[model samples]
Target: MELVIGIDIGGTKTKIGLVDKEGKCLEDTFFRTKEYPDIDDYLDKVVATIEELKDKFNYANILGCGIGAPNASSKNGTIENASNLLWKGTVPIIKKLNERMPMPMRIMNDASVAALGEMLFGNAKGMSDFIVITLGTGFGSGIVANGKLIDGFDGFAGELGHIDMTLGDGRITGLGVKGGLEAYVSATGLKRTIMYMQSKYLDESRFRSIAYNDLHGEDITKAAEEGDPIALKAFDYTAKILGLALANFTAFTQPEAFFLLGGLVNSGKWILDPLHTYFEEHLLEVYKGKVKLLSSGMEGKTAAISGAASLIWESHTDEY
Candidate 1:
């Protein structure tokens, strides 16, 4: 059967899947990324996995391959400075992968792929202009404008995480700005808030049993749902900053909606309600109620792969 391959290169592990044109994943596999010692080793292992898939399936109708990696530049097909990865500099991933597989290959940031996936087959389906925000180990934002992903002059546009939004005398520094939005809204950002709250609010019983260091965005959300005061405060803090940022973006880009993806968004109303409240509070009257913050309706990994698959499918169609 005709198929396409999609790969999501994450900080912890990598996911590979075979999918058809309609976004249905036919087969899927996951592997520990430690198989490789360096970027080159990782590429070798990836190529080897592709070869194995090809041999096992013997599928002649394979269309192309798509990859989503953090800090990836679609224009150059390189992973440039992923804060979560061990790599130090730019890695010419697409060139290396193409040399081995020799098929139509495309690469993009994981968040961008997720946004595209939603636009193509998920929550943002039928919408041409929107943004997808992935709140995980870090913050990732993707923009789709005029019906296509905006890969700026050098493929470095839509970097919403780096936007400045922090306020205070002793806030964390980002790049050069003090208290950037990322300093308050990302996984690390939220953790810092939780730590502060724990120090101020957690009593003996609460402090001794909880694992604050190991806590993730999901845990914070769950705690908030259970009426944990500390967790609710953290989400409230994050929501204020995030809502402010969204208000600012809405003024500039005027997208139809913003899709919230990743673990943090799963907190549901604990985060969303506050986010909406602040967003409305900060937004101008004209733009108020126009932009929405919605959950991603797409399958996470599958949506990314499907996005990668579109890299080839859409391009081929355009050519024909």
Candidate 2:
């Protein structure tokens, strides 16, 4: 019964869990990330938590530790330039944690970890190539090409959000392009689309009553599920762009499948229909019937933690 500590570090909270090689979590803890202002204090708390859990579980050997943080580098074991974290620069996370646990450590960006998790234990198990796109605050993707996670030369590969898409002279945001996939597919981006429609197409329409910022992807989904014209159109608009982007990716990598995850994807049919429709519509002729776009079998917080756990398994197995 070999076990490892897995941590999923988000902007607001960090989820720590003890997972066996079988992908089952034996124990878990949640803590507010803001509780500690300094990085050292943060690491200390994490170390103490692992110690407490190891002692209580009576595990003799903690095989390894794995962490999933936004913008983490798997090859370097460092977190670099995270948009949502308090850190301003590269931080050596592996070194700090190794001091406490004295075990092998692995780290990856949250999205990459999620993709890896899927490959190891979920939908992508036994598959060699696929992409996992998390539709949340932003669109994050982890790419696996040819049975291995593509780390690129600098270890910062698979930034699918920045893929360029035609915007037709829309208002520009800080992402610096006229329109990127992230501009239309992420949670924030979807809200922006809602605002655009309110001011453009829905000025005197009933949809205007819904507050722009307060409106969520789920709200739009519910309305769509009930056959609201406005919500249906919104899904169509967003899904079309996502489909096109996915088609472009398919033409290049030709992955066996594309795994969709995160809260926004919970829209179920409201999203999947249009997404699949457009993806197939725009796919290269040869890839028409080859690619599969599937919803993530794992959902919510567990998806990311599962990914972190897979990192531990991969790191341990690689040594042999």
Candidate 3:
């Protein structure tokens, strides 16, 4: 069976996997991304891990490697100014990896690869246009239009998270941006919204029992599940903001659907219902009720691995 290596680089951890063309992950493992402050050291460890996997699998049909990372650029094959990562400045990841392994390798933003995976192996299999929104620690987005990923001029176009909403009282994002969609709709944003609701409702809020530092998105989710008014309100507020943003996004791309991925999406109806409601309410008449709001069919390591592998598959087939 033809195989490829998929590497997903995140803020805290990096997951590496051997994936087949069928989207099956044969073997997978991870390492702490922050542990290796030196890029070369990290690359060395990655190379060693790949070699270990190759030996264990005893497979020689490996096609190439595809990496998905924050601030990754397909045009440059580099990770540039990634705020969440420990690396400083632009790192030529493809070049460094090729020096050791000497095979075809490609890289792009994590969300973009996820979108590609969705198109090839998940919910978007037959769709020609769609958007994937990753609601992780931070918000990330990938846009596919007319069966093509929109990389824009700098290969960094689908930054829907940074779309300014002009929400004057919005929470600040890790990038220190205020009023960005990520500041109000991501996991961190959920926590912030919960805290705000706790402050607003005070004694009447169950969240009052939870300390500020101890509060988490999971806590709010649990609370919402248990019918906590404050928690539900937090979800409502977050969805309203997100819906508005997505509605505006629709005006631009008019995709057939929008797929939600990541932890916050686990809240299910607590977020989706309100999001759908407000999205339609805010959408332009021509676009209303046409765009579908869907959950990602891919999840966990499978999604990441499949996405990375799909990158290589697409590259090999000259699909992008």
Winning candidate number (TM-score) = 3
lDDT of 3 by residue, 1-320 (tens): 67999999999988998887767788888889999999999999999888888887774589999899999999999999999999989999999999989988989899999999899778998898999999998999999999999998978888888877885655567777778889889988888887788768753667877776888877888888988998989999999999998899998989999999998898888999898899999999999889999877775666797798888888665433
Q: lDDT of each prediction vs. the true structure?
A: 0.78, 0.80, 0.88
The Cα error of candidate 2 at residue 184, in Å, is: 0.7
TM-score of each: 0.90, 0.93, 0.95
Name the Cα RMSD for model 2: 2.3
> How many backbone collisions does model 2 have?
0
**Candidate 1 lDDT, 1-320, residue by residue in tens:** 77778898887888787777667676777778766659778887787776676676784588889888888899998999776677768989889888877888888888888877777667887787899898876778889888888888988887788776534433563444566667777777887888777777754333236676776677776677677778878889889989999999888778899988876776778888999999999998999888988888877656666766666666654321
lDDT of 2 at 267: 77
Off by over 4 Å in 1: 167-170, 173-177, 198-212, 317-320
Task: Give Cα distance to truth, residue 148, candidate 2, Å.
Answer: 0.2
Q: List the residue pairs that clash in candidate 1.
A: 166-179
Pairs of residues at least 3 apart in sequence or in different chains that clash in candidate 2: none
Clashes per candidate, residues 3 or more apart or on different chains: 1, 0, 0
Model 2 misplaced regions, further than 4 Å: 167-178, 203-206, 315-320
Q: What ordering of candidates by lDDT runs from best to worst?
A: 3, 2, 1
| Backbone clashes in model 3, listed as residue pairs | none
lDDT of 2 by residue, 42-156 (tens): 9999888777778867845678888989888888889897878887788898888887668778888788888888887688888898999998888889999988888877778
lDDT of 1: 0.78
